[model samples]
Every structure is written in C-alpha cells, then in structure tokens.
Target: MRPLRIAVCVKPVPDPKESNRLQIDPATKTLVRKGIPLVINPLDRHALEAGIKLKEEAEGKVTVFSMAPPAAEQTLTETLAMGADEAVLLSDLRFAGGDTLATARVLAAGLKKMGEWDLIICGAESFDGGTAQVGPQLAVLLGIPWLTRVCQLKREDDNHLLVTVEDETEQRDLLAQLPLLITVDSAVNQPRRLSLLGILAARKRKVITFTADDLPVDLAGIGLNGSPTQTRDLFTHESTKKVELLTGSPQQVAIQLLDKLGLTEKGAGQ
Candidate 1:
C-alpha cells in the first residue's frame, strides 16, 4: 500500500498576551499588519502536532501551508522546527483585508499547487480570528468530506481512519474513509518542542513563498473586494460582576450564596 500524504494548514497570528488591539488604517478600513510581531496561531500548533504524529505512525510526508503577510515567514520556520517536512507561504498584498471566505479561496488554490495529498489537516480555529469556519468552508470548495473538533485518531485500515470527536452537544466516534479533511481540536495533543537539530535545519530551510499570481485564483474572490462580511464596530467590555460579602463561617457562606441564587436543593443551578 502507498504511504499517506498529509498537508496541514497553518496561520500566523499576533501574540494574544501582548495586545489584542487593532491597528487600523483610517482611510482604508483595513487592519495593518506592518511591524506586528507574528506567532503561530495557537490551535494550528495542535494540528501540526497531529500531522507529525500521524507521519511517525504511517511513515508519510507532512507538508505545512500558511497564508499571511510577508512577515509570516517566521511562522513557517517555527513549524519546520517542529518537524514538518516542507513549508509553503502564500503572501500577497492582493490577499489583504480578506475574511474567511477569501482566505479559503487562496488556500485551496495553493493546495492544488502543492501536489496531491491523501489527507489535509487544520486547527479548529485561528486564535486571532476564532471564526472556526475556514476549514469546513474550504472543504466545501474542494469537494471533500470534512470533520472538525477531532480529539483522537487511529488507523482503521490502509485507506480508512477512525476519529473520536466532540460535537455541539455530544461526543461522537466516527470511522472516516481516507482522502478526507480534518480539523484538530486544541485539546487533542500537546505539541512537541523543537529539537536542536530541527532548529538548525530550520535555519537553513527554504520556505516556498507564493503570491496571488502564482496560483490560478479568481482575483475577484481573493481580497477585500471578495469578502462579504465586514466589521461594523469594535470595542472592549468592562467587567460588571458585583462583589458581595457574607458574614458567616465557610459552610455558612456557601449556604448564603446558594440561598441568594435560590439553589438550596440539588440540581437547582441546572
């Protein structure tokens, strides 16, 4: 039987701890990425780890693809240090101000250029956007069956795969036929640290960079003009929880809180 060919889609995002502030262009209504420090999207790290584990088990090649501003090359390098065989970066000014739909269009085009693969993997969502729509939406464009929130995977056969995942309200164990797409849940696995050797190799690795013109993408469906969704307003919220004090012993305090919420009986909160 042939070995499995895996492709993992990754993204670069700003570090969450630093700042969630938007640098917007006043005239253009576009988010400015210039001079922004980029990090690998948190969820994507799990997806990459899942791909590496699968490669170790199945003896296959694992390729990673990312779309972002030109500075996002750092993200590709980081993934290589984590054990991806090769990396591809799609960076283009034409791809700026894109929403999820525009992102899927360019990514699907890049996948075509990267050669045929048996399985494609992605994070359930990007931490920066957290839209959680790109993977499944890309599958729709690629005409393939896609599964999300996959927490576990095992080989059922040469051409079959078993997956355990969580749905909106329940957990499901499913047997998926091969040549399908999957989005890994962040809680599925822990991503490994980069080995010294891998880091050294990453320093010398060549990440293939492509622009919008490099692929057969519909120019109309790739950037700001193609995105249907628009951000109308944005702001931050102040905490509104009121603090209360109870003059009582530990158990008495608990009882008082329960009484306040009318939860004197079991399952009252529910």
Candidate 2:
C-alpha cells in the first residue's frame, strides 16, 4: 500500500457562546480576543474527522495545519486528541489582522513548507468569519482542484473515491482522484468527542510551530498590510424592543399609528 499522507487545515475561533463578551477594535477592525475563551471552529472538526478516518483506513498519517495566534496552540491540542498524528501552527505577531485572503496565503505557505501530501482537507467555512472563502482560496493559491460543501466521502480505492457534495440545489456524486483538496460540510459526520485515552496519547504526538519567516511567502501580502479588503465601519446592531401603547377611540388609534410610522398625510400634503 502507498503511504497516504493527508493534511487538514483547522482554525480557532472564539467560543460563540461567549459572544456577549465579544468586542471589536476600532483601530484594527478586528475582534478583541483577550479575555475571550477560544475553541476549534465547529465545521473544521468535520474536516479533521474526514482526514483521520481516511488515515485509519489507509494506515497512513494525518497532519493538521493552522494559521492563528499562539494561544491557538491549546485549541490545536484538542484536535490532536481527536486523532491527528501531529499539528503545525503558523503563529506570529506579524500575521495579525489578516482577512480571509491573507489567512489563506499564510496557510498555503505553511503547508507548502510541510512538503507533499496526498490529500488536503478543510472546513467549508469558519463560524466566526462565515465567509467560507479560505478553503477555495487556499486551493487556488496551491493550484489544486477543490470540492466544497462535501457531505460524504467513501473511499473506493487507495487513490479514487465516491464523494457527495451538497450544493444549494442538489447533491452531486463524483469520483475524485488523489492529490485533491476538499472542504467538508459540518453535516459530513458526527464529530467524535475527545476521550481521556486520546488526550493521553496526544501527549506523545508532535506539535510543530512556524512563523511567516519560516515559510516562503511575500511579507507584503501575508497580514493585514497585505490584505486588500478594508473595513470602513464596524458596529453592532441593537435589537432591544421599543414598545408603545395606544388606547383610545378607533380614529385616534389610527392617527397615532400613522404618526408613529411617519405615514401621516401632513408631510405628503405639503
């Protein structure tokens, strides 16, 4: 059997449950991360599981990659327990304030440094960004064909397999070849929980960390400075309900309702 080597890209996102504490930095237009707990992106778990499953069946290796803050190292630990043989974290202060494109560039560079792989897997999108652009952008940067929103993958042989991708209209079944990149949907599988035994085993597994200097990438295009999109404004919408009561004759209520809605004839008649 050929030695199958798979690489899965994962991201760390702030725990969505703690969104109440979330804040944005006006100067940077980036989320304020301090004091907020972090967790692995929900959808990325499915991607990791896909790689792990393939590794188990193929008796190969599953390695994970990420471009995140150093704090995300803890988040990657949980992923190691989930079954990756090892992990590579591309963390650096210079990599901060990146948009999706910059992030994809960083990830692609890191993965390139890790050498060759038979398969590259990623989550369809991240919960925090929700742009779902990284997977495809990374594919383009690496010059690989990618299938997004993949729901199921059944390996037919060592290199070929039957894949089910969920499109907006319908599901597509295709025979995919090796050396392919795929972004898996969250519904692909029920992610397995991290057990005590797995955690113990992860202690022995390796976790390699890298910085932009460690990879071959243009310094001008790997961070916020390298990002093209700029946020002009960032603010939260207040959804608190404002209630008003009108109790009077039908005519009076009608007038009041119209006035509240600015539909009164006063301005129109003028």
Query: Model 2, 106-200: lDDT tens per residue?
Result: 99999889888888999998988899899999989999888999999978887876899998899999999987899999788888999999999
Clashes of each: 0, 0
Q: With candidate 1 superimposed using the best TM-score fit, by how many Å does residue 133's alpha carbon deviate from the native?
A: 0.4
> Number of the top candidate by TM-score?
2
Off by over 4 Å in 2: 239-270
Candidate 1, 111-163: lDDT as tens digits: 98888878899999987678899999888888889999999887778888899
RMSD to true structure for each model, in Å: 4.5, 4.2
The global Cα lDDT (0 to 1) of model 1 is: 0.86
